[model samples]
Target: MKLDILAIGAHPDDVELGCSGTLISEARRGKKVGIVDLTQGELGTRGTVETRYAEAAEAGRIIGVSVRENLKMRDGFFVNDEAHQLQLIRVLRRYRPDIVIGNILEDRHPDHGRAGNLIYDACFLSGLKQIKTAEDDGSEQEKWRPRYLFQYIQDRFYEPDLIVDVSHVWEERMASIKAYTTQFHSPAGTEGDATYISSPEFMEAVIARARLLGKRIGVPFAEGFLSKKNIGISSLDALVLQET
Candidate 1:
């Protein structure tokens, strides 16, 4: 399906933690959105792959995405090699999204940074026409490259080229994150042992990060993104003016 936006994450909840609110706000505005998870998050200490798959589906429904696909790459070992790039390219051709949102360039988790670079390279390669891919039917796939490859800020802070005001979808965004009950922290008891992400503090920090980014635009909450390419705005009125 042709998607307006395709969000990719190294693991199940990466998209939710990074850009789910913005995605939800966009989807609620009638934009077609999709998600591609690079792995099942099997290397994680808490939840199993089976549970992560279920949680991811639940989160996708909450975000109202057109599709939620998993590449099934090794969670912690996936590399940015030719094979991996071709696999990602195939998905890009099939989805043909205008905007591709990827993980943070560099983060606390090494996988996040690797994934960010991997998607960045795959995006360029996908547009090369010569880098061939095929559809499910084994037919030739058209070369497709997303116009914007945005890297969402995750564990580490980086100056963002743009910020998406997601104040309206804050509640729904939190719900989506919470949907990954197995991976995220919950006040209620779960089957697995506690991890860094499973702590109440981490959840609070996530909200705090949104608030911090929102403050830049005088919004209640927002999602920040970094892009190496110049971001074009239609007019000056489109920008958020600073207050004295």
Candidate 2:
């Protein structure tokens, strides 16, 4: 199905952690939103792949996304190569999203950076007519390129090119994130050994980051994004006039 916004991530919860708030905010406004996970996050210290799928679905529901898909790329090892690009290109063409939000170009996790670069290349290559790709039914797929591509801030901080006010959907956003009980701290308790993200502090830090970004624009909560291309607005009315 066509999407107004497509959020892609290297792992299952990556999208939820980074851009789910913005997705929720948009979906609330009746925009079509979807998510594509590059990997099952099988390499994570906690949670089995099966549990990850279940959690991802629950998170998608919380975020009000229309569809959620997994590319099944090798966790922690996928590379930005021709084969991978073609695979992602097919999805990009199929969904025909107007805006694509993906992983940060560089991050604390190597997989995050690699997937970011892979997404970057695939989005551009998807627009090339010569890069042939087909659908599941063996029919040829048409070339499609998103009008805008932005990377959500993750793990590491960079001055964002834009920040979306998401205070209205903050509860839904945090609920979507907490849906990954195995990945993040939960009241029910996780089954696997604790890791850096499984700790309560990590969740606290996630909230803190949102608040910090929100403070930049006089909002209660927000999500920051980076864009390689300049963002344009039709007029001054598009600007947020809240006193900062």
Candidate 3:
């Protein structure tokens, strides 16, 4: 099915942690949104791959996305090569999304940075008619590239070029993030060693980060995004203006 937006992440919960709120809001408006995880997050310290997959599915339901898929690339070793680009291109052409939500251009995790660049390169290559790709059904794919690509902030913070107000759906977004019980702080239970993100403090920080972004725009909660190119605005009234 054609998608309005495809949110991609390096690992299972990356999209949830970064852009799930925005995705949730958009989907509630009846937009066709989906997710593409570059890896199954097999290299994570806590959760098993099987558990991550289950959690990702649950999160997709909570966020109300139409589709959620995994590329099954190597957890920590995937690189931005021709093979990787081709794989991504196939999906891009199949979905033909207008906008793509990608990982931060640079982040604390090396994989995040790599995945961001890989997505950027793939999006461009996917639009090239010369780059041939095929669908799962063996049909030749057409060239497709999203018109806009926005990078979500995670781990370390960067001043966002845009902040999406998610006040109306903040609690629901939290529920979606909480769907990954094995990955994040859970009231239910815990197994194995505690990782950085698995701690309660980390979850609190997540809420705090959203609130901080919201404060910048006088909203209760928000998600921040970065754009390499200047965004176009039709009118000043359409822009969210903060009172000085």
Candidate 4:
């Protein structure tokens, strides 16, 4: 189905930790939003692939996304090669999203950077008619390119080109992130051995990051995004005015 906004991530929780608040905010405004996970996150320390799938579904539901899909690329090893690009291109053409939000170009994790470049390249390549991709039924798929592409900040922070006000959906957004009980610290103990992210400090950092970004724009909470291209709006009315 066509989507107004499509968020892509290298792993299951990547989108949740990054742009979920923005997605939830948009979905609440009646925009169709979806998620595409590049990998099953099988390589993650805390959760099994099966548990990841279940958690991802629950997270999607909490975010109120119209659809969520996994491309099944190898976790932590997928490269930005033609084969992987074609796999991602197929989904891009199918979803035909107007705006694509993906992983930042560079991050602490190599997989995040690689997937970011992969998504960037695939979005451009998907627009070329000669790329030639097919549907599940063997019919030819039409070329599609998103109108705008924004990369959500993760792990490391860079000055963002835009910060979306997400205070209205803050609680729900946190709930979505907590859906992955195995990945993040949970009050109800998880089964696997604890990892860096499973620590309560990590979750605290997440909230602190949001508050820091929000303070910049006089909002209670926000999500920052980077864009290679300058963003434009038709009028000043589009700007959010700080409360007196």
Q: Name the best candidate (by TM-score).
A: 2
lDDT of 2: 0.95
lDDT, residue 65, model 2: 94
Per-residue lDDT value at 217 in model 3: 90
Enumerate residue pairs that collide in model 3: none
| Candidate 2: tens digits of C-alpha lDDT, residues 1-244 | 8999999999999999999999998998999999999999999998899999999999999999999999999998889999999999999999999999999999999999999999999999999999899999999999999999999999999999999999999999999998998888888758778899998899999999999999999989999999999999999998878895
Report model 1's TM-score to 2 decimal places.
0.97
Ranking of all predicted structures according to TM-score, beginning with the best and ending with the worst? 2, 4, 3, 1
Better of 2 and 3 by lDDT: 2
Cα deviation in Å at residue 37, candidate 3?
Answer: 0.6
Runs in model 2 with CA error above 4 Å?
none
lDDT (Cα) of model 4:
0.94
Q: Write the per-residue lDDT of candidate 3 for residues 1-244, one digit (tens) a residue.
A: 9999999999998999899999999999999999999999999998789999999999999999999999999999999999998999898999999999999888899999999999999999999999888977889999998999999999989999989999999988998899888888887645779888988999999999999999989988999999887889899988877674
Error of 1 at 132 (Å): 1.4
Clashing pairs in 1: none
lDDT of 4 by residue, 24-139 (tens): 99999999999999999999988799999999999999999999999999998899999999999999999899999999999999999999999999999999999899999999
